[model samples]
Target: MWLVLAFAVAGGLAQLVDGTLGMGFGVTSATVLLALGVAPATASAATHAAKLPTTLISGLSHWREGNIDVRILLRVALPGMVGGFLGAVVLTSISLEAAKGWMAGLLLFFGFVILLRFGFGFRLIPVPKNGERTRWLAPIGVLGGFVDATGGGGWGPVVTPSLMTVTRHEPRKVVGTVNAAEFAVAVSVSTGFVTGAAHQDIPWLPVLGLVLGGVCIAPIAARLAGRLPHAPMGTMVGGLVILVNLVTVVSLLGGLPGWLDAILIVAWLALVGRLAWRAWEKEKAGRLAVVGNPGVNA
Candidate 1:
């Protein structure tokens, strides 16, 4: 009961954040599962399975809201699906405890990329269909899919940042397209886990709890992303990505002391706060600067 409730709540919160910010669902949910001592392979399988519903709902909402790019979705999703399948197979064969460390490091690296994007106000847009730059999505999708399946969660963390840094699309659209594409990745990862891993590996109750909880909030999160101002949300999502991965990295490094945890959290909060203030100031300035003629009045 308590366990079920915890999983349900965690899933809901994760979905909400993922939907709103374009990332965090799998990593957040998997982090919690790992803390509860779930096996790595099982955790990855369960996370992928749980993502089925959340991603479906989220993708639908984004599609309806005109946030997705069909071409981008197809291009990236196909490779991601292939990568996810391969990653799941690798996870089953490798010593996951060792693999987990590498995954954490990789995620942490991307977390910093996201922060750099937000910190510097990068405005990378997508190129034309015929442009060579558009081809980069294939490799990004491949890496994203592989890491996501093996790490139990990282598609958005990896895909979103890479796309944002290189692509010419708006952040909101990229988030939506990536999320919409994630349906394929999630499905592929789950199939790999179910057929390749031990049949009894997944914990059914936790999977059910997460799915039930995530379904309810999935639409709401997509709507929020569509409506929310991009800059502020980017800061929030970037900060959160870094913070969450830092915790994971810390835990992997034999866990931190109480004071260290507090210090890290406080620092994280301070960075978000500063970014938030800057976003607000920019918004206020934009609002004040109407496009009306500056001709002399009267």
Candidate 2:
């Protein structure tokens, strides 16, 4: 009962984050389950299973809220479905120990990417004035799906940021589109996990708890999507992903010295705080400018 409650809470929290930010449900839930000694295959399977209903509700809520782009959703979701299934098959074929390492590395990479993109506003390429050409979306979808299936959560983290960078769309639209597209990815990944040859027994209790908690919060989270400040939320989520995965990597590396761990965490927190403050200041300035010059198009 206690375990079920714990997962329920975790699921609610993860869904809140994912629905608002367009990512984190799988990453957060899988991280917790892995920490609790669940197998990689099982963890990924459970995460996707839980995500099915949650993503469905989230997508619909976003659609009702006018956050979706039908063209973007179809383009990204179809390729993502294929990639997700392939990724699940690949993950299931690998040995347990290797899969853990793979997940750790993938999570760490995505964490850093999130931090760079959101926290520091790093961009590798220039943004086009109108919008990015649609040709690039298919590849992005494939990559996002592959990573999400293999890492237990990445479609949003990968697809959302990538879209935001290339397109001129608002944050709410990008987040909504990613969250909506995730329903398809979840369906494909779940199917792959079930059909995989070395399928493990899923933790159905946790899945149920996650589903219930996530469903309850889906509408609220969708409503918050257009209202919340993206920078602070993105920075916080990136920091969390990095921190949690760091702990997993440390455990895999025969553990780190207690002092070193504390120092590392403190340093990371300081960086996250600095970035978040800068983002807040920038946003404040932008709002002030708009208020000062109501005639100008901000």
Candidate 3:
């Protein structure tokens, strides 16, 4: 019971960060769950199950902001649904240990890409323009859906950036639209999981706790988002992601000795403490900026 509560609190904090920063929910939730001794597949399933309603709420908020592109959603959703189904099936068949190794590698690659200083960073695929390129939406949707189901999170890391690059939308608009569209994906995939072969592993209590916690914190995070400077906020989020991936890699590779795990946990606590302090400073600065320059507005 207490463990469930702890997981819920951890998930809520993750949701707060994700809601405000435009990313991090899946990775954060999945990592924390794994650290708690849950199987990777089970953790992914539980997280997705819980995220369905939470994403819907956030997506609706984004929609009210006029950030959704209905046409784009219509184009991608069917393929995404199919891909998510397929991915879930695949996950059921895979070895959890192997999946963890692959997931760690992918996370490391993504982190490295994000850390790049210049010249294309991590994006290799060029943004598709109009016509046939837009048609690529189905395949992209399929892959994103599949990976997200299997990995526990890919909306922000895979789908949002891809859509933004392809459609040339503003970052904020992309974030909003992606959040909305992901609600659809999460709902579809989660429904399939509930009815399909993967239903047995569902951790009902923990999942419910996570959903409730996320619901409570989401609005608060969203409200804070508009107040922070984009560049610094993005950098901080990216840095945190990098640190998380590094830890994931070390843990997966058996590089973290027994003694080192304790040290890493302490470091993790310190890192999160620093993040909170920085966020407070940023919020204060933003408020001051607004007060000192009345005409400037984000």
- Give the best candidate by TM-score: 2
* Per-residue lDDT of model 3, residues 1-298, tens digit only: 8866876797687677666656667766765565566776677778788778778877777677665677777677677778777766666677878877655555555444333311113455676656235766787788877877777776566766577567766555666666666777787777666655666776687787788778787666665555444433444445555566567677666676778777876786576556545655665676789799999763
Residue range with the least summed lDDT across 10 consecutive positions in model 3: 113-122
Q: Which regions in candidate 1 have their CA more than 4 angstroms from the true location? A: 119-132, 165-167, 230-244, 254-258, 283-298
lDDT of each: 0.77, 0.85, 0.66
How does candidate 2 fare on TM-score? 0.92
Q: Provide the lDDT at 109 for model 2.
A: 75
Off by over 4 Å in 2: 197-199, 294-298
162: Cα error in model 2, Å: 1.5
Our model 3 lands, by Cα RMSD against the true structure, at 4.8
**Residue lDDT tens for model 1, 84-164:** 999988887777677667656655665565555555465334434543366688998898899898878889878886776
Q: What ranking emerges by TM-score with the best candidate at the front?
A: 2, 1, 3
Order of candidates by lDDT, top first? 2, 1, 3
Evaluate model 1: give its lDDT.
0.77
> Which candidate achieves the best lDDT against the true structure?
2
